[model samples]
Target: MTHEHAFSLHVPDLVFGRGALAEVGEHARALGLTRVLLVTDRTLRPLAPVTRVETALRDAGIEVILHDFVAIEPTESAIDRAGAAGQIHGIDGFISVGGGSSIDTAKGANLLVSRGGRIADFLPPPLGAGRTLGGGPLLPHIACPTTFGTAAETTGIVAFALDHGRGKTTLTGAPLRPSLGLLDPTALLTLPPMVLAANAFDLLSHAIESETARPFESRPAPADPARRPVTQGANPFASLGCREAIRLVAGALGPALDDPTDIESREQLMRAGLLAGTVFGMSGNHLPHALSYPISTLAHRWTAPDYPDDHPFLPHGLSVALAAPAVFRHLERRLPDRFAPVARALATDSVADALIALMRRAGLPNGLTAIGLSDEHHPALVEGALAQRRLIDNAPLTPTAADLAAILADARRYWS
Candidate 1:
């Protein structure tokens, strides 16, 4: 099998600091945007972060069209609604000011407005029309994340749920990436403790997965260099970011959660998120993220604190955390050397044990069972995880269906 000898790193233009969000309007004008669509969720509409961005944009003489219908976890319908708003307003650009859902909603809206098709037209087969995006340059987008996890601002992927919660899928390409990412630590001040814990775990997962993903040299070279996958696997440039992110999360997550007003800890956590985000796309993720899709899609009884209570919601990070310890334990046997840096960064001999300890400290769910899954759900969980080939294939040693099933079984309960 031929292996790749080259890799590429793509990151959005970034402005990071305490008050970086206040400068978004200047950047939007620099991008030549006159009228912009501001996408956010209803829950965040009255929040300080949203108000701050709105004030900044109007202060710069930019016309803002507010679209606050974004769901907690974005869905196809939500994306279409946001897209329709953009079309109606003839928005010249997009400014997303919430979590991953809001940013991804803006991405979907931008795609529909620029490419002139439904989201399904660009999705993969069996779930979508399997069409590719070549619709010329999409409108410029500037993403401001209120949460610290998903890193939607820095990625070229848009993940959303199918209508009625059938499942989750993604639209991926360079055009989907935001033109700039505004990292403002103060945006996290309103995050609840449980939400903060989930974010920290998600940050940890990004760093570890990037650090242990299949090396670029191990992947098959693309027949066309121009078509090289956005996720190029572990490379030298990404490793630098991954290691530091792991160390920062280890030291700062606890402090930040203990005191919501601790700006210093919040700043550290935000930096950790930024570092992890910049690199994870280059390396991709592995089993835990793949497994998270099923865990979230099939959830029937779990509800998280400080989230919209209208649905049976499981925050993305918590779902990923539930599967992480089991997945990492499975990987450690095969990739002990790769996990050494992670262990050193966490100051622990066993990465899985350290994760469990952290989860306990953060008051996270005990495991999959805690979230209402049982032995009967293993088949569906395994099948769902296997369907995420993009994430599954990035593992250094890809798992077979049976391997996934066993992992699910092991993940059922981490503690009594």
Candidate 2:
């Protein structure tokens, strides 16, 4: 079987390394952004570097506008509000200064301001076919990643809620990808314990899932660098990244989350996040992300003060983590050979077992029951997951209703 694949990777002009945030001002100027709308949540507003991002922009002679109203887990309404504010302020570009929520919100605002439409109007498959942005031009975006999850910086997928329509709608367009990404690990040092844990798992899930999602392949010689390998179902670029990413997450997340005070551990987590992002960003996310959306949309849970919606308020990383173990076990059965590599990355005898152990060590919940999923919600949950074909389409094995039914069923009895 061909283990090597060739594919073009879509990533921003990534500026990585320690203290990369200090160069934010220069990067913004290079993009010719005269004025920038700084998007972040209130909790992060007080963060020194988060504040410094704006200061750095001004120091570089760029006029800065602050819109720190980004909720922890932002909804479509929140994104619309921020976008309107960006338009009103005439932002030349956008700079996101937090984790996935803040970055996702900033991406949404840029879309609305540049594309001119309701968030739902741009959902997948038909995104760039004929969409027109009423706004003058596509404003550039620069993502300042402070946390170690959701490589929102390298991706063109802007995930937002569809409040009245009942779930999330994602917009995917290469033009929507941020023009630049400044990844600085130092900024994450001050994150609260829970936030760190949640985000780490989000990174972990991306790595684990992406590693196994490559489509099946028949034995063939490794292709030349320019020729991308053909897998039965998975994207080649995504598969390679997934393997490396899983290894990094397995080694980095635990130490980083356990001791946030240690810069080395933090840096490793940031590296892991980037690796996972680069891998899955191209390969595409599957079941865990798909399943998490409905639970997020339907759950009555409320997150931190920054997140004020009742729209199933679980964090993206947390939601994905909740469904991971079950999903991994289910997929493992379909692709048993895939398990060996994941096991090796995870440094365990079994991939599914390793993932469950990792979740437990990270203090993540074992199953949906831990997050309030019950027998009553099984039908709806299954329906929601099936509807997320974008994610399920990349699953290692084609999932059936019976398979999903058992997964959710096992999830209920998992830890509770």
The most accurate candidate by TM-score is 1
**Tens-digit lDDT string for candidate 2 (245-287):** 6777778777776786878878877888887787677666778
lDDT score, residue 193, model 1?
92
RMSD (CA, Å), each prediction = 1.0, 4.4
In model 1, what are the clashing residue pairs, if there are any?
A: none
Q: Lowest lDDT 10-mer window, candidate 1?
A: 128-137
Q: Candidate 1 on 1-416: residue-level lDDT in tens?
A: 78899998888998999999999889988999899999999889999999999999999999999999999888999999999899999999999999899999999999998877788878877787888888367999999998888989999989888987688877788889999999999999989999889989998999999999999998898999878888989988898999999999999988988898999999999999999999997789989999999999988689987777897888899999999999999989788999998899999999999999999899998888898999898899999999998998899998999888888888888877
Candidate 1 lDDT score relative to the true structure:
0.90
Q: Rate the local accuracy (lDDT) of all candidates.
A: 0.90, 0.75
lDDT of 1 at 265: 93
Model 2 RMSD vs true structure: 4.4
- Assess every candidate by TM-score: 0.98, 0.88
Off-target runs (Cα >4 Å) in candidate 1 are none
